[model samples]
Target chain A: MHPLVLQYDGDSEEKISKIMTEEIIIAGFGGQGVLSMGKILAYSAIMQDQEVSWMPSYGPEMRGGTANVTVILSSERISSPIINTFDTAIILNQQSLDKFENSVKPGGVLIYDGNGISRHPERRDINIYRIDAASEAAKLGSAKAVNMIVLGGYLKVKPLVELQNVVKGLAESLPQRHHSLIPMNEKAIKRGMEIVNTVHEVG
Target chain B: MKELKLMKGNEAIAEAAIRAGADAYFGYPITPQSEVLEYLMAERPHERTGMIVLQAESEIAAINMVYGGAACGRKVMTSSSSPGISLKQEGLSYIAGSELPCLVVNVVRGGPGLGTIQPAQSDYFQAVKGGGHGDYRLIVLAPASVQEMADFVDLGFELAFRYRNPAMILTDGALGQMMEKVWLKEPKPRMTEYPEWATTGKTPDRERNIITSLELDSGRQEKFNLKLQAKYREMEEKEVRYETIECEDAEYLLVAYGTSARICQKSVQVARENGIKVGLLRPMTLFPFPKKILREMAPKLKGILSVEMSTGQMVEDVMLAVNGLVEVEHYGRMGGIIPAPDEIVSVLEEKFIKQNYYG
Candidate 1:
């Protein structure tokens, strides 16, 4: 059996079983790779032989507009892909932060990139973390790795999936021609992991 | 051999069609379903399996192309969303009337008109009751997951050719857009020879096959209609496919199909956790309706809730199937809104458990 599958066994640690099911919403502007973040995370879960679903807003809503995707990863079968609330919300911009902050479940995690947010997350019941993913990607000389950076921050907090699986997922999600950029993406993820700060939390 | 891959439902359908030895795919681009065409184009099935993929000028042209190809005994299909499907209704009716074997996929979006580009099962009545004009029915298969979306392509074609009729895959935007792991079937080689009934250039020793829906003689047309009815009856008898979970000792039953069925499954889990005896009945083939199962289970259930994305389409079918043996209620969210599992659980409790248990 896959190591990840064994992690969900009944005798596994309580923390592993408690977070076995992760419902996430990633939202941002069209070009910010919000949907791609969700796609990569979903792919990583699939690599671990986990049940996963990724649903993105398509068509006009994705053309120069706010785009979002819902991703669910579970040890068991996922019943529905479309969900109203999320266990985690990865908001990349001010609009996304405003739109999705309230949808995060109480005690859930909300990770946001500080680049586009003017108003901070106000939710008291949820854990909020901020990472400057855009600046990190810019520093790495690849502005497109913003999503990867955000994903790295999410993993650091949640630790639901392993980083090696995420690298494999990145190769699967991107075309072969762009594979050289994987190293840059990996750098961005590590930068995100190092830079994320917890802004708010509940006792 | 089982090869597992993560794929969107739309992409899975396209790959499965090619693997199923589909001869041609004719479709216009439409949201939540464009991946079906996009994947076919990207994969270049023509080069791989010699399957032809064409982007027609419109959905009307696409359905007509499917009709033309199917008449030649080629495994052909077309896919579209709700509004685009409306455009193909005329061609669909002609395909059914002429008794052509083909696949028509509708990745349904919300609708009465050009509704939201989100998932909705409002097309349930249109698909199962024959949306096009005439006394005709297309064998309808409802796929809830990406795996089913892939598997049903071959199943739909098999049933279609078995009865010499068109088969429709009725799915919603959520199922079409969502990504999941799918175990792809082994690729079947494309058919090189045409069947005897096909309009493949008639041989000198055989009578030429004429493909047309128009029967000049009214009496002959009436007889043809009766033959079609008999075929539908056969399908109803033999093709009713469904799955039941925890129905053996359940006080509450939920009837749902496609994406709604997935949500209802979650509701079943939640209700069970709360000590409510809730079961889920998923209709795999919507046209056959799984009436027999419902009729049998209705007597043992305290109440049935028809959960759907539409206001109340399949509920009517449930009521008809139950025949007033139990109280049937519908809880739905229209205009592309999906009801959450918690919402479904609350509604189920209010409608059945609370009223009966606390009253």
Candidate 2:
């Protein structure tokens, strides 16, 4: 039996392949915890026995400039840690929105915070969602929870990883001294999942 | 016990070195590869396996440190980026010339002279054909993933000792910085029994052991050179390693190594999805160059494309191997810019399926 057809009911050959391989790009400012989110996501995939690769943007731009990371979670061996397009792009800032809005493959998902985004995503071929994570973080009195909120918004839409695995990933990646903050981060994720607003849906 | 962990490439290599029972590591920190020294320092291999990890003042100093450790037949290694690698060339030549075993890792960045701190395979030529001035070759292993980054440290050390020559893991910034899951092998205790040629001091029961690359007599130097050539030939005959994907029915083949090879794997899948029969040939051992396999696969291939992160370095070797049995071309993106997978298929289609049709 073909691996791609594990859930097959004698249907289409291209059935559900996009779900098998999730090529995600998370981009924002240097201190946005963007790389950490990618790491946690990669670790979560590892706990599920999925092959994962995380490549970060560590050029001159990452020196207090824009930061980005490409995270791939796949059932098969992933090729090319570097890529031009993405299956999902979690954009945080205005610059990232402008750069990667059009990079989402047709019928893909785009999740971004509405904080710095002045000109919103203008693509109609992909599904776009808005999360006011900055405001939500301010409400929680923890500005550092912005990334988790946005990551939560991403999970509500895709749910590619189990919630328990994500929590375990959060605990595993965090230092023992910082493990007490996990509950707050989990709460921020729940708030994000609740507040994610749909903007444009392709289908 | 098999330990699995999600680790960056640099960290994996550092952890693997200690587990491989390496005696010492001397290195200077450079971007895209700084994590290696950092991880080593944090892990404190001196505590784990009693291995010595030192941060040398410069790349030159570090490679010489490796040379010193290797002279005593210790499993020693050093790592650096491009400009730092250029600084260690003289030391590399000396190590190769003296027939000492050592591992040198060049986590390559863009270069001519300090080009960029981004990933690139421009060092392919420098790595395969001796960068330092001499008639010698370093056993070069190009690792494509974080797993290979960890796995190659042991393989690199094994090969270096097998031939009594310097071995290098020629990876790029992308592989150095990326994070992936790797299953680490169980630890091996450090070697207490050194090789016979080691400078372990003269004793009443044995003759004095000397290690040097200098031979003042021209005739003796030529003989040494011939001996080195024979060693390299043996390596060529026995040590060529590569990986093939989707080639059973492939009409076109993409030859690449390291990060470029990873990208070409995706190109093979994309081309196949488009009803095109494409395959990927990834050379794991870049020094031995995988010439024998290419020669055998070339006759059946309608067209061959050499994809690299640099501009046409490895293509020369591919063209030489194929000997024009099939049409060959080169595609690349320079200055730390990685080529895309889908675009590689487009180049294959344009180059082979478009106008020129020769086999």
Candidate 3:
């Protein structure tokens, strides 16, 4: 059995569950796995018996343009998937940073990859963290795992869902052929956790 | 029991259709709803249960194909977005006139013609008020969640067959595109037997069944119209489905369906937090419209507000249901726009709470 499968059974009833609602937006270029990152988070939330909604920006906007997704995870039943404001914004590029930085609610968190951001986040009311996810994934010898790295940085800060549940979620999201890459993705996540730097903390 | 899968609403509809023992799916591709066809084709349900999945060249052709399949007493379905659904209006009217049992899903986008591909409930009038020519009605099921998207396929089919009337899954682009954990039902085998009324190569021992809407005789056609009216009345009595949240103590009521209903649900929570006695009345079946509940609730509420993605289509129904027993107002975002929860709360405050509005 996978480690996550074991964790899934053990954590239920034995562990004290926290009830929190987090509305997050993941934004980047079209092929940067922004949607996938949101999907993975949503699936992880589901594994923890949390209610989640994942809404992606689709149609022509997905043709080599900015791609984004809104994910709301809650202990209670989620009301709506479409939200204008977000508790956290995981920005992958400068364009996404410019578009979504102001949309983050005050006293919330903003995590961004420093790869393409020319201007740092200017919000003083929210907590901001910068992670070199691209470099971390490149160092891990798997450039495609940038999303996993960013996701790791997210979990490190919020820790809304358990890491093992995320691994189970990854297994569910990825096809059977890509299951071999789970270990690499796990390493990328750990690297992300290690390298993330907090730029500002909310008081 | 099958484990829950994180699936898109459109994909859920496709999977649910197969599990509901749908015999065939003939649909054309459209934004926000193309996933329904794509998932069915990729899964090759044809091999899974001998269910025929065909990608028709056009929406018109798809609806005609559905008509053909339903005529032969097969469980058939088709899905499309707003403009594509418009193309099937003629076929929809004919199906209603002929009293065919089939499912038509309209994952609506913003449109008077070719509009934006985002979510909109602008097609409420089109769905409930008879878009095609002649007087007819479809059992319209509006899903607020991805789970309902999966569940309603079976329910829609059940209702369709029970009444021998066409049923529609009226959803918007947002609900179709959004993803959630869906607990899929066990697969049911494809329907092998149809009703005796089905025209499946009638034998010499039995009289041939002719499936059509062509009653040229004026008296007979009027009688058929009367029969349809009686059937609709029966449906209104039996098929009215809705959900009320915090309505028992509410002084203000929000009438909404589909995606707008989901947003209004959040608004209900927000309004309650602000010490406002607001509630949400979500109609699960739009055609039946939940008029009886609205009529009963109207006397106790200060006012009713109909929130929609379109420009006041369902508000008309709300007003008709309330029938001046309560003050009714409409707040809407048109042309692919969706109103936020706070926006709805503000609208509620400005329109109802502040004015101390009462009917």
Candidate 4:
């Protein structure tokens, strides 16, 4: 077993087990791993004995354009997997924020890249968390790994599943050689966790 | 036991097909309708309910795969948007000529060729009047909402087998992308009952029924054509469905379907707000064309304006249905351009205002 798999605490496990029934949405441009993020979240929920649904939005010209996905995790059977509004929205780009800001239910959490998104959203009713994950991941050598950094941001706001459990889910879901990439993700996750923890402490 | 939940029209159709005991689904991806395939892929009911789903190389393969599956007496369906659906015409016509039962869903997008991924109801004539060569007809169902999207799956499949012909759900991108509350029924737990006429392979007593369109003899081919026409007539009598909106004392009736109907609904509301007394008649089934209702309503109205996403495909149907009982005119936006309710209302005001008031 990898150290990343064991990094999750018992409290996170209890939290995940307690409220595994939740709907999550991850959205961004084509290369942002929006679909894979939904897949990982759905697979993790499935591993936790929850009913899961993952829907990816892709068209013929979706590449290099706007892309998004909806993931549903619930205790009971889900009827239709398409989510018109979301409880949690992870937006990685400005277009994702623009297209999805109105779609978040009031009081829902919105996690976005602070560096990538310049303008603050006009609406202040919903909970918004701006993460400079792109810069943080850039320090870790792979700017493309910003998705994992945002996943870190997701953990702080909606930590329904344990960080270690997510790592384990990724390990089980991804191929073998990809296992080497886990440590960087764990680092990114910790960086994300610190931001949320600081915000809570200050508030 | 009925319950309502908000759903997109595309997802509702997928859930409804699952509930209707659809045994197989084969399709290629296309916008406005991709959610149907995405839903089936995520649900994977094939593993639990003995269903099968295959993403084919193209729309041609998908429809042919459906024909192969339907020949085995299995309830199967395939869906595509405009351009992709045009590719399935050959297989659709062959299925019709062979009298096979299958369902084809066209969640229409704007098109002459990949014109745009926006909603359009331009395929009315292709769906109802037979897109391919032959004296044949497909039972076409046009759903206007998420709830109806789900309900029409069962209705389309039932009528497909009932008439031994292909049934089409003629929806548009708006219906495919919009969301609403949908009440889903529990899955039907039994195998679909097929008629003895269906081509089940290699059965001892049946002598391996040949499913083909090759009646070499001219008289035999004519006999098959007449038989098909008779079956279509029976379907027209039994399966025609339409909705009349506030036409009790209307002077002008707007004819529309699918996403166009939603726009027309708004137009009717706005026109009524202006005291225009303009009502709407939406044909849920396009093939049967709701000819009887239009004929009956024509005498009561001054004229009918056939409004659609296509330039004038459905206008012809409106003309045929009214059979010149009253004046008929057409208003449309084509090449994937969606006409707004206000635009349609302007056409109505322009066309009818002079005739009714000035005349």
Candidate 5:
């Protein structure tokens, strides 16, 4: 099945891929697999024959605190790896939202964990999608899968990559031991997708 | 040929080095330049291109490995920010005196002792006037863009081998950190053979070649120095490169390079917008020093502003280039801080405009 349609329906192929070349930032607290998630997304783009550069931010104490990664994927060779601002940012934690919300381009998407954030971003111009990714991951009996859940939510909104491509990428990239875990990750991803679909419907 | 891709300066340098047919890279992790190492590690070019990337024990070890590889006529390189490059100067001087060919990249950071890992241009004299003791010069190419950073690898290695000397790419934090579109250059054609002078294994037909700077006689050492000076003179004739912006009808010229030149480029636009006849002279090569270019520009120009990220190292070179042909002024913010474009504009306004600045 088409990955973008897994969570989002009624979208033509042409309309779904308008921003596929756009730069995105995936940022959150440490241990959220933010870097890996960005890498997979970036690799997916590269697999589609697009140019990509993935940059992970690490201070002297990256593991002890927040971490972020900037992924620039384009048809052209990417210059300057650092993103002064983002066309879209998928923020999984509150600190990340607060840290980068202002820097997002007007009307840019901000995907956040609904279970963690108590307040909606005060800005009216920006598009905000709240996914209960952590709770969904907990329901799947794997809190560590929250990142995968969030990635699914991101796939729904952007749909720059096809779901089948992501599945193939995960299969090729994951270790053998982790291959068994892909089923659960896919389930968690679907859960996150459903939450966004429901919200996009009501709004 | 027509597409623009955003890339960082450090990544560009690494991509460029790979395309330039560099066989080996040995480097220690350092800020603003870690990406160069990281990109090579992830790409793992060894499988197809036979490039070797090693994370060395220390900067000293890294440079030594470079020395060993370069001794074998292999295209080799090492990169670090500031403090780390300081540790490699001893080896650099030896390589210079031994007349070896290699490339070194110093993505500069603020410094003196464990300075912050931010951008700075304080290594101007270290790179241009020779960092290690004795009279030697490196062919230093200062890149202002990520595209240039990748393109300079081929140019740097070509010049290094041509002159049988070390070449350096002096870039900084902003360029390393910032993203801009870049088109990677086509790889250069590989040389079919090393120079007859390269150190290969000792052959039975010929005596074993010794790569050393040792000279037991004072006269021999003096002769070596004289010969080195002649090589530098030839380089001065052939290798000097600089960029001029808005200078044809400008009154004041701001001299800078690398990331500083990027800022000066912006300053020129701002100064011009504000009705100040200001322009920039950015030296792309710090060691052939571009003295002749400056000497020619100085007579036609008003006062010169030598803006740097150090406490004025390149400013001294700028002054030497002018040689009292015109009054030279300088602005500096050391310890790794980048001087603001507005501050530079203000300096041009006050020093050149209000002070009746004239050559």
Candidate 6:
């Protein structure tokens, strides 16, 4: 059996029918794998038969190497691929944190890697979580796995997509020769979920 | 079951072209739409379906290549962004005059010159009003989602061949770059029979079919022009594709298309939630303009806000269609800045709901 196929409940169709639409914004520097993170999430949504739309900021605005992607996972059909606010925000760098901190809905979730955030999100209505994904990835001896760790933290917070689908998504994204790395990446996801700390909780 | 995949709008168009049994693709790379060419190159459709994908020397060259393939009764296509599309205007005019069946996808960006690479509907006039020099009409299809981007390739071909005219998929940089789920059509086999007008090799059984835009006799040229006009009128009668959302009991209408239409859909949700009765009319075929529907619904509408990512171009067409039955107003945000759904709602309030200033 392939290690990538962790678990298969084959019950996403029944559960996802009741799941509300989740609009997410992932923002960071261009090279931080921000786009890939959103892509993985989008593919995961597809695996569960959810309607998904991934819109990225492009052209001169991204020439600063600043990148952002809006991913909408919905049980119903998505109308606008482009949106102003988000239900959840995953911020990587301080620039992104400052930019998108206010775009989260009042009762939404904000997850950030607290590596260089000078002014953290001060919102009281939304939930804030600080994930030291960079630090955790450094300790894991895989600097490139920072995105996977952050994704893991998000999954922990939401768990919208099941573990089985995520494993399947990893299998789809990674080449066959790199299938051996799936277990390692899965470990990073688990690490993200474990180390993420809640800084603020909305009542 | 249908095959669905998460694909960018540009990638969807490319894949759809291949699956639609396109004979060839000739395009130059440009921002927000370069993916169409890049995707085709990566897919290597030649290997799979004997489809030819080539990066032409220039947009002009690419369009001419499309003209050649289209004239030969092949399902050929070409794509470019705003400035590149401008470069293909001459070729487009020739293709229209020659009455060739081909697909031209323009992923529009902000432009007058080599403007911004961001998404904009500023090219509305260039597309629907005939950007070329001649008095010609190209059947224009505007796709609001990635799914439409895929579906329009097949539909564009069908419509173009039916009229023996040029058809263009007029979209913007946002829809071209954005990714969404798309159910691609099954692979279609390449053409087995050429049209009677096609410039295929002449057999002994028939006269050689000549394909040219040149008509030296002024009387004959005028007749050809009249024929083109008659064909356009038929299209206007048959091909006026649009969608009306929540207009059943609305007092005002929001008219938009493509990316703006998608945003307006959300605006409708927000505005209705706020107890504002507003609906949206999204035109899928811009050239046909859905004028009849607008005319029919005008008497009931308090006002019509034609929202676009331009300095207001489509508003003129809306006004012409309405013909003073009600007020028609133009609301737009230029420079590739996509307006938020709530922002559009505010524009409606300020423009019509607040001041009642509807043109």
| Best model number under DockQ | 2
Q: TM-score of each model's B chain? A: 0.98, 0.98, 0.98, 0.95, 0.95, 0.98
Candidate 3 lDDT, tens digit per residue, A1-203?
Answer: 00100001111343326547899999999988899888888988899999999999888989999999999999877887888889999999999899999999999999999986779898899999999998777777878889989998999999999989989998999999999988888888787888899999988
**What DockQ does each candidate score versus the true complex, computed on alpha carbons?**
0.33, 0.40, 0.32, 0.03, 0.05, 0.32
C-alpha lDDT of all candidate models, in order: 0.89, 0.91, 0.90, 0.77, 0.79, 0.90
Tens digit of lDDT per residue, candidate 1, span A10-75? Answer: 123564455478999999999998878888898898888799999888768788999999999998
- How close is every model to the real structure, measured as TM-score? 0.94, 0.96, 0.95, 0.67, 0.70, 0.95
Assess the local accuracy of residue B239 in candidate 2 as a C-alpha lDDT between 0 and 100.
Answer: 86
For TM-score, candidate 2 versus 5, the one ahead is: 2
Candidate 2 local Cα displacement, residue B86, angstroms: 0.7
- Candidate 6 lDDT by residue in tens digits, A48-120: 9899999999977676678999999998767788897999999999989888999999999999999977888
Q: What is the lDDT of residue B343 in candidate 1?
A: 94
Tell me chain A's TM-score in each of the predictions. Answer: 0.89, 0.90, 0.89, 0.82, 0.83, 0.88
Question: How far in Å is the alpha carbon of B168 misplaced in model 2?
Answer: 0.3
Candidate 4 yields a Cα-based lDDT of: 0.77
lDDT of 1 by residue, B1-359 (tens): 55788898999999999999999999999887999999999999989999999999999999999989999999999999999999999999999999999999999999888888888999988999999999999999998899999999999998999999999999988889888889999899999897788998967998999999999899999999999999999999988888887676889999898999889888887887799988888888999788998998888899999999988999999999999999999999998888999899999989987786677
**Selected candidate, larger lDDT, 2 vs 5:** 2
lDDT of 2 by residue, A1-203 (tens): 00110110111456535449999999999998999999999988888999999999987898888999999999877878888899999999999998898889999999999997789999999999999999989999999999999989999999999878989999878989999999998998899999999999987
Order by TM-score, highest first: 2, 3, 6, 1, 5, 4
Fnat values, one per model, are: 0.43, 0.57, 0.47, 0.00, 0.00, 0.53
Superposed by TM-score, candidate 6 places the C-alpha of residue B34 at a distance from the truth, in angstroms, of 0.5
Which sections of candidate 3 miss by over 4 Å?
A1-18, B356-359
Winner on DockQ (2 vs 6): 2
Interface RMSD of each: 9.1, 9.2, 12.1, 21.6, 18.0, 14.0
Residue ranges of candidate 5 with Cα displaced over 4 Å: A1-203, B1-5, B188-192, B204-207, B355-359
Scored by lDDT, model 2 comes in at: 0.91
